[model samples]
Target: VGMGDSCAPSNNLPYGTAMEANLIQQLTLRGWAVVVTDYEGLGTPGVHTYTVGPSAGRAVLDAARAATRLPEAGLSADTPVGIMGYSQGGQAGSWAAELQGSYAPELKVKGTATGGVPADLLKVADFNNGSYGAGLVFMAAAGQDAAFPELR
Candidate 1:
């Protein structure tokens, strides 16, 4: 997913949906319908809640709900779903699985597959403090602060 406003998916900018589009394409190739969501503020009017599991998780589940209700999509609440993601998405997908029961009990989630989840923001920041991904540390910091403003 794009990290900044300049590359938000709603901007219709190139490389906006590059990350998981390939995997989504694979599912489509198999004749399955797919839907995606731009987390809590990634493509909207406020600060992108990057790394915020609850927001991302709710967005993911909500997308599924919306997709199922779309008249043209011909989907229903009974439709099965399998969530998967990598990196930032990995965390979101994992959170979705955890919250699916209480947040969206109607979703028939088959399974969840996630990779490279940032289980601990502190560890992630510390590890990337002086590495090539140093900028990610700052980005994560801004995102975390935005999501948990009381802590700021």
Candidate 2:
């Protein structure tokens, strides 16, 4: 399954970013069914959780759980699962990797591929300040605050 990037709320899954469409099509062509998430709040009411690692990771793993339970999806507990994402989504994928062993031990996750992962958010903040990636840093901060209101 693919974890979609950060995006504005949109209840319609088909209207997701082009990247989501491409991933779904490519995976389907290769004989693999796909599932994706709009994260905690995007495409729903309230603020998105954004970069909160545990929240995002849980959403990804939960999607896999929900998918396996769907009989029409032809997925089983034994079916192999792979997680892929980029940028903000990459950080989420990384969290899922760390969380899978304990949070979703039943899942047969074979692998994970993440690109442009913000391995260290503080580092990202320091580097992106006054740079082109500043917007991303701001979003991350806001997301954290929303998830953990004490931070605000």
Candidate 3:
């Protein structure tokens, strides 16, 4: 499956509202069933951790596992799953791939494709010269701090 920007799965809006509808349509035409997740907390509670890779990855992978149980997916647990994303979605995809070995080993993740990945928030901040993107970098830091207090 593939994820678009933050508006894609992490927010249950229309394809046009989230990402390019044509892209989803084309992927579907290519015999790929796409499943999107609105992350853990979007319109619910707490804050939207923009580039929190681990949280993003867990949401995507768990959503995939949940999809297997849905009649529309028509997939079994043994099915080889692949994840791909760009931008914020890329961070999520990368997290999912990195965590799969220990987090969801039963999912059978075949591979992952991530583009425009923000692997290092500090680096991204430095590259962007601490602009609005730097705020996102800050959000990532908060997420990491929350996920791992020891790292703080």
Model 3's TM-score against the true structure: 0.77
Each candidate structure's TM-score, on Cα atoms with residue i matched to residue i, is 0.90, 0.87, 0.77
How large an RMSD does model 3 have?
4.1
- Native-to-model Cα distance after best TM-score fit, residue 88 in candidate 1, in Å: 0.6
Off by over 4 Å in 2: 1-13
Q: Pick by lDDT: which candidate is best?
A: 1
What residue runs in model 3 are displaced by over 4 Å at the alpha carbon?
1-12, 130-135, 138-152
**lDDT by residue (tens digit), candidate 3, 20-52:** 456777888998777766664444354554567
lDDT of prediction 2: 0.80
State the lDDT of candidate 2 residue by residue for 40-132, as single tens digits: 766555677777889889988998999998999999999899999898679889899999999999999999999989788899899999998
List per-prediction Cα lDDT, in the order shown. Answer: 0.83, 0.80, 0.71
Candidate 1, residues 99-141, lDDT tens digits: the string is 9999999999999999999989889888998999888887777
Model 3 poorest 10 in a row by lDDT:
1-10
Note each model's CA RMSD in angstroms.
Answer: 2.0, 3.5, 4.1
Cα deviation of 148 in candidate 1 (Å)? 1.5
Compute the lDDT for candidate 3.
0.71
lDDT for residue 152 in candidate 1, whole number 0-100:
63
